[model samples]
Target: MEPFVLRGPEATLSTPTPADVDRVAEVCADPEIATWTTVPSPYSRADAEGFVTQMVADGWANDMMFTWAVRPPGEVDGPVLAMMGISRTVGAPGEDQAGEIGYWTAPDARGRGLTTAAARLAADWALDPEGLGLVRLQWQAYVGNWPSRRVAWKLGFRSEGTLRQFGLQRGVLRDSWMASLLPEDPREPVEPWPAEAPRP
Candidate 1:
């Protein structure tokens, strides 16, 4: 299947390429990724390349998941900054047509509110009838990853609940915060970008 590009207020989501492997490796080496994500502890260039070649390329070909690169607007002279993605269309047997979104920005790319904006865009697209008809969009982040939790909250995802020690990262089990938005929630108000949080 041909990869499709998705739009956001300030980012353009596209499929990853071999040329991006080096940039991905540079960003994955950041401590922030190690702190919040499941990236390898000693993340190396080879690991990034292998992942780009296998998990991203082969995975997309096999219909396991869809990946995208979050290119920042106005970046024209250097490495194209990117974010990793893994999502399946809703209702493919056990998936229930529910698309879950997740992302991480480069180190130098933090504090810009880009991820939050991009997430809202991605969610809107996923929920569109032409896209995935996703009845629910979910986000899960480690308890202490305030940045990610903040993005979810900013995008109108309510604090549904938490799963205690539901994930194992590195060598320890960690608690995860789970939040979601449903089609009938009426909480996702239709308005301008950065919509106000619906009153609970």
Candidate 2:
């Protein structure tokens, strides 16, 4: 599939390139990122290179995923502010089409709403008939990832409760919170949620 770019209010989302290796390595190396995400611990230059070169390439080629590197608007060549993607999900027999969204924000770019904006853009694109035309977009995060949960909630994903030992982080099983956004759901925030609600 040919690569494409999606421009949003605050950021531009595009395919990752080999040129982004160094910056990707630097950002993924942050302990906070490693702890919260599945990114390799003690991330290395080689890992970053493969992520941009091999992983992204294969994902697009196979139609299994679509990954985008987010940057400030009009700064497509600038440092990556975050990485986001939707992966096609292999559902059970007789299930509707589905995909799962995942993302990680750069440490320096936290609290700027860049990821949220980019996520909305991606979700819109994924649900468009001209795009992937997926029926629903799933979201999951290890329990306690309030930031990620907030992003999902802000996008109107219905909280679907928790999955026990749903994810593995560094060889340890961890519970995860799950949610879903359907084509019929409003993109804006829905009913107010409890401030103390558990997060994925």
lDDT of 1 by residue, 1-200 (tens): 55677775587777777888889888989898888888897899998888778877776677656677777753422355657464763567545577677788887878887777667667776667666567787888887787787777777777767799986788888998887776665334332322233456
Q: Which tens-of-lDDT digit does each residue in 11-95 have in candidate 2?
A: 9998888889999999999988897888888999999998998999899998778999999897777779899998889554345
Question: What's the count of clashing pairs in each model shown?
Answer: 4, 0
Candidate 2, which segments miss by more than 4 Å at Cα?
Answer: 91-95, 194-200
RMSD to native for every prediction?
A: 4.9, 2.7
Report the Cα lDDT for residue 118, model 2: 95
The candidate that achieves the highest lDDT relative to the unseen native structure? 2
TM-score of each predicted structure versus truth: 0.83, 0.92
The lDDT of each candidate is 0.72, 0.87
